[model samples]
Target: MSKTVTVSDQTGTEALAAQLAAVAKPGDVILMHGTLGMGKSAFCRAFIRAVANNPHEEVPSPTFTLVQIYELDRLPVWHFDLYRLSDPEEIHELDIEDAFADAVSLIEWPDRLEYLTPENRLDIHIEPGSNPDGRVFILEPSGDDWIKRIDQLSRDQA
Candidate 1:
């Protein structure tokens, strides 16, 4: 099963991110999909902040760095932006292996992962909503673990 959430503004998006963060754990993979300005990076920032339990936590987009690892007491969070990725094989250089095996991973431009993408993951596709400032998030869980975990989401607005 999947869940769809509609939010009227950026605050709503951030709230949803925080809610998801409350249920996330180590080794969970979140694949973000959307075009430019769809707030893919914004979602990741909010998620990382929530996981850190620090609303002021700095969560810079990994657009240039490719990967940003957030060290937390619960577990590390690897935020990856593969927009500049020239080759899927380059993911190794970003230590994606470690992210997949031991940490919570938030990947933007996940299509760039190519064959390196994990099978067990929660794919979040962002789309424009009815209003100009509104947004729609389609969350699809893959693999048994993800499917079960997704049910724990607090969102039922869909």
Candidate 2:
């Protein structure tokens, strides 16, 4: 199942992330796609905040750093930014397989990675609308688990 959400601002994006965080579990992979300045990092920040139950926790974009690992209530959240990566081989050097094996991963610019295979992933596409604050978020499920989860999430929201 798939779902689409329209967010008007950063707060709405955060609220959506928080809602997802409540249902997200270990071993889940989230693939985010959007142009620059589309609030992908902002959504990630909110997701981590909700998962960690720490709204004040600083979740910065791992642009230059590549990946950032956060321990939230004993669950490891791995956030990856591949915007600066020019080669897919560079991702292999980062040993992302290990991170995927141990924690939940939120990957930005996943299109840059060639070695990774998404098993159970929630694919998010964010598009800018006519209004500056308006955004169109399209959620696509990549596996059976996500299909069910997304369906449930949508139904619950309804």
Candidate 3:
């Protein structure tokens, strides 16, 4: 299933991230796809902060570092940026298989991974909206489980 959410400002974007974080847990994978400046990093930062329960935590983009690991009270999170990767095989060096085993993974530019990504995952596509500071998020679930979770998210927000 799929759903779209419009975020008007940075705060709204963060709120959306926190809401998503509430339903996410270890062993979950969230793939984010968007062009540069589409707020993918911002959404990730907010989600990481929420999961860590530290609103002031310093969450940096993994563009250069490749992957950033955060140990939240609930579960560990592995945030990955594959934009700089020249080959998908490079992911093996990072031991991503281990992280995906029992961690919440937020991946940006996941196209590089292609079919390597698990069958069941949440794919979030971000795009520019009509408002100057607005962002439109298109969420596509990979399985029935995610569809139910998305519905719960909507009900929670309501």
Candidate 4:
């Protein structure tokens, strides 16, 4: 299933992330796609903060680092930025298979790892709108569980 949300500001984005955090489970894979300055990193920051239950926690983009692992409320959250990757095979060296087995993975610039990403992942496309600070979030669920969750989220927000 698919749904779209309009986030007016960073606060709204954080709120949305918090809501998602409340329901997200281990083994969840979120693939985020967007251009530079499209708030992809901002959303990741909010998500990690909410999951960790520590708003003060630092959530930096792992563009150069490839992946950053965060211990959130004792649960592992793996944030991966594949923007700098030259090939998806390079991900093998990061031991991502084991990470995927246990943690919730959030990937930025997931297109670079399309072949490696799971088939049941959640795909999110963030787009810049006509107005500054406005963003259009397109969410597509790749599996039955996420599809149901997306539908529920849509109804709850509506």
Candidate 5:
């Protein structure tokens, strides 16, 4: 099952990200799905900032860098962008296994992960909504950890 959330603007996206960040813990993996300009980076920026409890922190996209690691007070955050990756095997160089075991990971262009994708994860598909700034999030949570949180979030949104 999936839950859909509609956000009117960037602020709405940030608010949603904040909610997730508050509940996120080590070993949590969030797989982001969307096309170019769909605000995946924007959502991640907000999520990392909220998790770090810093509103002014610089959250840059890992597009060229491939991955960005942030050592926050709680735990590390590994943000991965696999758009430029030509092969999934290249992920080995990023030491993603460590992030999988100990940190909270947010991935963009996760399709590149292929067989390496974790079994327990929350997959969020972003699509354009009614307005220019609006976005519709279709959340598919696979693990118990995510199902419970997403269920609560559904009720909260209701």
Candidate 6:
């Protein structure tokens, strides 16, 4: 199932992230897909700050490091940027399999994972909106759990 949310600026994007944070938990995997200059990094930064419970926390993009782990009060977060991955085999080296069981994972360029992606995951595709500084988030859930959460989000937004 899928849902779409449109935001007009950074604050709107962050607000959406914070709403997701309210329902996020350990073992959740969110795959982020978007072209460069899209708001993937900004969204991830906001999500990370929300999870960390520190609005001012400095959460850098994991573009070069591949994966950055953050220990939050409620659950650990595994942020992965697979854009620079040379091969899918490299994913095994990062031990992401372990993150899927206990941590909340936010992955960028998850298309690089190919078949390695979990069956129960959330796919978030972002794109530029019609207005300047606007963004559209296309959320597709791979499992019933996320579908229910999305429904709740819809009701809340309504």
Top-lDDT structure, candidate number:
5
Name the best candidate (by TM-score): 5
> Candidate 6 — worst ten consecutive residues by lDDT sum?
149-158
Model 3, residue 148: displacement in angstroms?
0.9
TM-score: which is higher, 2 or 3? Answer: 3
Global CA lDDT computed for model 2? 0.83
Candidates arranged by lDDT, highest first: 5, 1, 6, 3, 4, 2
Give the per-residue lDDT digits (tens) of candidate 2, residues 61-151: 8988999999778478999999889888888877788777788788998899766756768999989955798777889998888887777
- For every candidate structure, what is the RMSD over all alpha carbons to the true structure, in angstroms? 1.4, 2.1, 1.8, 1.8, 1.4, 1.7
Q: Please provide, for model 6 over 1-158, each residue's C-alpha lDDT reduced to its tens digit, 9 standing for 90 to 100.
A: 68998887888889888888889999999999999989888898899899888999889889899999998897889999999997899999999998999999999999899889999998999989767788888889999999888767642221
lDDT of 5: 0.91
For candidate 4, the TM-score is 0.93
Model 6 bad stretches (over 4 Å): 155-158
* lDDT-best of 1 and 6: 1
Question: Cα deviation in Å at residue 98, candidate 5?
Answer: 0.6
Cα-based lDDT for every prediction: 0.89, 0.83, 0.87, 0.83, 0.91, 0.88
TM-score of each candidate? Answer: 0.95, 0.91, 0.95, 0.93, 0.96, 0.95
Model 5: runs farther than 4 Å from truth?
A: 154-158
Error of 1 at 17 (Å): 0.6
Give per-residue lDDT, candidate 5, residue 125.
Answer: 97
Candidate 2: segments with Cα more than 4 A from true spot: 154-158
Model 1 agreement with the true structure over 47-91: per-residue lDDT tens digits: 999989998998887888889999888778999999998899888
